[model samples]
Target: MSDDDGLMLNFAIPDNGTTTTANTQSKNVKVRGGRWKDRRILKLELEGRPKEKKVKGPNSIPIDASRKRRMEEKPSKPKSSQSNPTSEFKRAKFTETKGEHGGKNDSYVSSLFTNNTASTQEVPEESKEETKTYLPSNAPDKNATSFAGLGINEKLSKHLTDHQRFKYPTKIQKLVIPNLLVTERDLFVKAQTGSGKTMAFILPIFHKLMMEYKHKIGRESGLFAIILTPTRELANQIYSVLENLNRCYPFLVPGIVIGGEKKKSEKARLRKGVNILVATPGRLADHLENTKTLDISQLRYLVLDEGDKLVELGFEETISKITKIIDDNSKIDETKDKWQGLPTRRINILCSATLQNNVKQLGNIILNNPEMISVDREVEGTILFDDDTTGEVQTNNEHESFAPDQLIQSVLIVPPKLRLVTLDASLVNIANKIEQSGESSRSIVFFSCSDSVNYHFDVFTRDGKKFKKVKDEETGETKTILVSPDDSADEDQDDAELTSPIINKNTIIYKLHGSLSQQTRTTILQQFIKDDPKFPHKVLFCTDVASRGLDLPNISNVIEYDAPFTIDDHLHRIGRSARVGAKGNATLFLLPGLEEGYIDAKLKIVHPREENLRVTKYETILSSAFGEKNSTTKNKFDKLGNWDIHATTWHLEVERWLLENSSALAKASHAFTSHIRAYATHLSQERNFFNVKLLHLGHLAKSFGLRETPKNLGKKSSKNNDKFEELENGGKKYKKEDPRKKMLRLAKLAVNSTSEYNY
Candidate 1:
């Protein structure tokens, strides 16, 4: 037989059996002959089975009559010829059940992904009246006739008008100068920062000393006044003010003895004698104890400038010691005999911007039978010299910390990843304004830590070459020499780095913080104050070090790049500008989400006037940051499209710069870690708004040009584990350090830092 004819076996069906449709179809279907392995079992399995044959007659089972009736009554199921019995019905299209597995997991994974589309919801525009920060009217005050009207000496007032440019006394000066010049009673002076508090107390002392000099009183006579401050900067500033006043009367000498100065020089000057002395608490205490030439037995005035800060710096004990020593040295009999027209006994004047509990406590220690003098809040843009206003004003402490009315304060609700670019944009805007105005302008940027200030200073100055100061042999003129990395040591680099900028090309950049040497800090402050007509814009990146008592003139803007530790800090940071009613702007950069609540919960109290504050959109700032031609793009014709391009390109440039320089990368990492640690140090009351636990660590790292995950970035290798191991028995393993102890150590570092005093 042929291969096709090999399967010849056939089965016959009886005629009586009913032919089902499946069986009939199978009967007609043919199978090809093949080897046993190739035969299809599945195909055979599809065929329907035949019914079994019944046994003959009585031997087989009898059929019941009801069986036919039941079979006839049952409805038959329709069978389709194309249906396969072995195949499963299609599964119901997958439908996700709602709320399964405790709903979707909450995650911060989205923060890790870069949002290429900078699609931000449009922030509502505030009304002109609501957003506007109105400057105090320049309209002539009928009462502000001259400094002489405020009880200033005629010669001193004339000199001030001619040289010092005292057109008119400020509100604080109007209130304080007259009281100090006329009364021998102790005074507690409280007013807004930048409201002429320094001049207030200084002028009265100058007037009294100038009056005494006419009686042939010289520096050799005795020390008539001693001014104590919290920081060396403030003390030096007060001394300078005294010197300026002294230009009229050179016989009345002023001397400063602050930290970071040569004791020998201070001693030598003291031996020559000074009519008025200005010194920091710690240094003054040392001088009183160690320097015998420093005589306070004839001291007539004890003026504590920035008294609140003096107490805040934990100098209360030192100040107490100094005050007690002064009391013991100054005999009532000697003070009465030394000078006429001045107080019979030493008059105590405590000047502070805010009257918090600590300040009150400080006042109790230094001030006796004190008269409380403060600007009345009810009278807008006016100072009340009404003698009836006595005792401490019973008001909210929050209200007491209000910013100056002329300061245009705004808040930017920015994301962590966008902070760097947004800051650059804001600075560019300020620079552009300076360029358009054709006038010299100064600005300050406040950071949370010194490391952050250093990192940002490097980032901004990376594009320019550095130069160092050199003295010319023939002309004897000091000039700068181009300093290259190969020729320069690491320590000398920062001195020349301030002259460069990556974005604000014409703007000079300066970095200041507590970490800088005292001399370096003093030099930078002097340079910032000295206006070089060549550079129109000057920006200083500093910590709270620049926020306090140092009066930097003509500061047009202040940028609080980091949220302050307290509301008082926030007020003080902005107080650097808008001095004595000058128009100025301030911006606070706040991360979005929980931090946004600060605007209403805390900031409103410090800035009650709605017109002085507005919410600035980060998108607007980012878009305006780039010019007509994107600097990153080489092609002039290739224009940038949107905010996303500006942010991404700028951040990428920063990251690239960090990658190329290992030192900068290390600084950035250090700044990132320090920032996180500092963020946790906010006051307990402010924890609701600035909770570190709510922060997105990965996103914040991007601000510092860091790409590593937070876990990896903060994790240190176990390199010291071997050092802790014992030598016996292959070394016993040391237990892990307690996290609570680690946290306490970091807190101690923050508290002990000099950041608060410097600013």
Candidate 2:
């Protein structure tokens, strides 16, 4: 994550986690000296397109001209597949650095197999006791399970296990592999992040090609499979997985094409021919119109990894263009009777961690009767599931981030100005704790945009990257906000003592993100994978690219250096750590001050609103964890907060109503607790400012505005509001009436009076 203008931000920590938006109130609050907006952080990019390029003249040769010539010469190339427009981030063309390694184009390199890729090649046979329609990827006795049971190539099965220790098929892999291998089914899988969806589609499709077509597959069919990913990082991730699996069959040529690198090497690679190609949609589209040697007329497999993100990021047109060619060509291939006895069929598979409407729409256009597979959020199942029934329950809502039971999650609220300092302290605490226990720990720190990513990276590594100078508009005084405190502490700096231990002889930090050149990114990942011979990487600073599909080893902690834009993002970030049944820790950095995190971006310093009920929401997150059943949980908010609202009696009335009702709602599903925690965090992040006069005038009401449940809305309340004295911050303490107690009592009462329950 380096500072650039691609994946960007305009910060305001809203009631929900989102970036690049804020309430444009008329009044501008003053900060330090200038208006808040002037002093606010300006984020350009998070991943790639780190900086805006100088505008080139319209007459100048276009950056993608090399690819454009192929489409012009080739009559068979589809017109719509040619994307002349620039990609998001408005990426300018990049050239290969001098002395860069130009890998061989004609032969497959041994890049996939690491030193220990086959550390344990021999595996025991799978158990016959398991005969479920679906299977868990990892089991308690994973050694007892095998992919061979699912009719996989025994050699392929053995390699997969050794490559990544994928002992058994993940829920996605278990169901998806067979469908792709045996049938003509299209798939739209909505599994939890890190559930092995990449392997599910890759293993089956690649295996089929190696068995049937081999190296000549591309020569005859011209790009047998086209895997489209949203980002270059993801393309590389898919490429790595596919390339390693390609080791099981050397004849299968797998390659990747992305932006931010010279097109010559990729073109040469494609010219020599590639059977399976993983590419970012924009770059692939660029090639479809330009590279004459590259052809997708016989493309059979089209997989959209992170389909939701691709659609959300506005890649619909590009995807459709690629799909259109595949669609048109598949019909031609069928008409020619090429697949009389072969398993080759144009298959469309879309996989996303979060299932949203756009993703479904994308699938509808590309896939025919595509099946979905969602992993359980609370627990990974060990038994079989029905083909029609995916076990998608309300409790397993995708809005909540999924962490394995082994991951220990916690949060620390820090003032914005102190973020860098606080990060140091937290790291020291974690390292010291681990050192005392005589254990090694690996961690990844994620940021919202590349600017933040690069800033933190510079600070952590003590790199001399220039820290931007910010001026106080009123005073005209400037200072570097993110300079490494140890390396270049400002003369007037106050927090001189704050510093995180950068690295010792035992530690190494690695950086990975899309903004870097493709070559550098690849080198960083490969070195990270091998843990570098000299400086073994223990910590990685990156953006969300590392969050998806790329499973690095020995990751003990995932740190959200910046609050993620959505709950899914939060899940994916942490998902990088506690992967495949390993213990890890995650810490979310929250900035509640004007000088710090997202809150600082807003124009005004607003106080907390509805202070009383905020307690219950947080307590819900804690208490619900101990409860086994949603209906039986008796947790309350009394122990949650002080429940002290210094307001008129009318405000107390509202608080009472909320407390009495929210408890029951919280118990309706397990996800409610997570929702409550997220809600509370949002409240803390927002500038809390509600009119006390409105409450005194009886203008305040429960279940008002764009709220969720009003408990039998359109009907009158079952119990009337009671009369009470307006005690300052405590209308009625009511004898040990802690929020938790109230929750337990209400839960029991609601369960007993089933007729009165609105849920």
Candidate 3:
């Protein structure tokens, strides 16, 4: 009837059923005065059906005697209407059996009609099955547009395109660019390494620079951006990235300031004005101290890359100093009036892979209320890279697939006297294994300490010696080659000299450690990464410093000559080889009881392994030098098993004693006396003496009186007020000395000391 009330209907009938009426209204004609009345009426009826039917009686009711007899013989059903048919049913005729049948059929047909209409008028399948779409809580809304999509200003886009990053924005960039483009707020971002974090802040700084350029804000007085990193290499890396951007853009200039490089040249670059400056905190501070004219008053953006490592490497003090000089709230602002009157207008950005406590504290001091964007934690181990051209993807290699299942991690438990020889032999065995496996050129050897790094480097290089031809006096520039160990001579003579060619040619070795100059370190690392096929096999002797932050693409085997201090460190060492879907092999050499001690100590730090790793015992090259039947061999093996237990017990006892008697030994003099008393007691018991001798007492006193004695007084005594005087004196003496020289000296001293000390 109306649009809202409109309803469609349909009907169906059984094939066996007879249709009643085609049009009910046509039969509703009413007669008035022998003619159809002029009024509309409706009626319902069955078509061509008789109103009534009746059956004729059999002739004379079969009154014959035979008919009556046959009827009587058949069983007859009882008929009752209170034992008799009602006279009212015949009179009314409406209670007939035909009427009852019609009523029941009408009710059944009505239900069938209703069901057929409902079935025919059902909604379409596609319309009924439609569903609403759901999106993740953290994902950007579908309707929202990103900074890049919103017609980013030409200058900003130009800078981004120059860096070859003109595609979609990273999560951090998408969240930060809008806020930074309008406001100057310090941001502290905690993100994984390879998450495009560098470009997040860099893009915004470029945008600000472009805006300033468009507005014709004349040349700024100081650097606009200052980026600090923990190491020289990282600073250089950032510098390289920015330099590439400059090369592509042609208008921007970037400067790098780091240690182990020229300062005057860096200062010269700064005087010329740079849009961005990347530097190590220490070197940058040094430059700031030396060059008063190189002001950073115009510094707008500050970025700390790898902030976790900056704190780890103890650069917090330097970072604080640098920040204090730049920030408007710093006490150093008293000297600001000496420079330009421009306001600081600074915003700090911190990026780190992991947020250590110290790093968080530092960020709290530097950044304002910050927004946090974290990629799923589970997906962190999965490294994702997009192809610039084809947009293909890749994933990291799982450790299980890369490492061999049957490769045993064993420790060659050698006595302290033979530890060096054991290490040497282990290196040789690893080299041989790599060569035999046909992958020696892709193997790496890890050493614990720098000294060991140099030692193994020398040994391996010597073992794989190559000689060049030289002119002989008799032969005048003839090409006569000199063989290693003088192999051209007798065997005894060859062996007598510390020279051998057989051990040399099979392996090429390189050394790596923190102490090496950055140039040397990078060169050696690059060479290792580019291990030539002609060489077939090369060995890398490195300290733990090389274990992390390096992507060695072709390392097939990793030899842990010295066991790692913790399981995480061990995993990181082995992780170097088996990366980005490559199979790798790892072997460890544990000197007998060394495994137990490391395992016990390691469990206190990292998650403990459910079961101990499989370890195999190898015959010590040193132990075999003696006769196999010697009692010394048996005694040595027995001692090796008990060494860890004895050492642990002794360490625990010492720790307990220090904790209990620390207050009594607060004074340096008192701590020294205690050390003497302990040593005297040990000597007395060992010598079976009832009392200490004057000579022994004198020796103990002298040992305790040495300058190095205070370090042996344990943590508490070293941390006490008495040691403060020694620290202060040392600091003041080196206050005027070169900080680098002092740092080197202190590092060396720390390395050499076997005892724990505060300073």
Task: Please list the C-alpha lDDT of all candidates, in the order they appear.
Answer: 0.72, 0.51, 0.48
Q: Best candidate per TM-score, number?
A: 1
Question: Residue-pair clashes per candidate, as listed?
Answer: 5, 22, 13
Ranking the candidates on lDDT from highest down gives 1, 2, 3
> What does candidate 3 score in Cα RMSD to the true structure?
40.2
Q: What is the TM-score of each candidate against the true structure?
A: 0.77, 0.53, 0.46
Alpha-carbon error at 408 in model 3, in Å? 13
Query: Across residues 1-759, which tens digit of lDDT does each residue of candidate 2 receive?
Result: 215534333344223234322343223332242334333422222211234344322223233544555546877633341231101111122222222221123221111101111111111222456422222222223543468776678888889778757777766566667777877667766666666778888888776765663233544455778888877667777888887887777777888888777889889989988888988888888888888888777677788888877875678898889777556655435533554433456777787876555665676557765555555443332212123355222222333223444555555443322234445545544554555566666778875444344544544553223234689899899964545544454645322112233534445566665556566677666656564333333667776667766677778778886666455566677777656655566777653322133322321111111110011111122222211233334332232222111111212232233334554233322222211222222223332421111111111111111012323222211232111211322666345455433433333333233221010
Pairs in clash, predicted candidate 1: 544-759, 545-758, 545-759, 546-759, 548-759
Model 3 collision count = 13
Lowest lDDT block of 10, candidate 3: 109-118
- Root-mean-square deviation of every model: 17.0, 29.8, 40.2
- The positional error of residue 591 in candidate 1, measured at the CA in angstroms, is 0.9
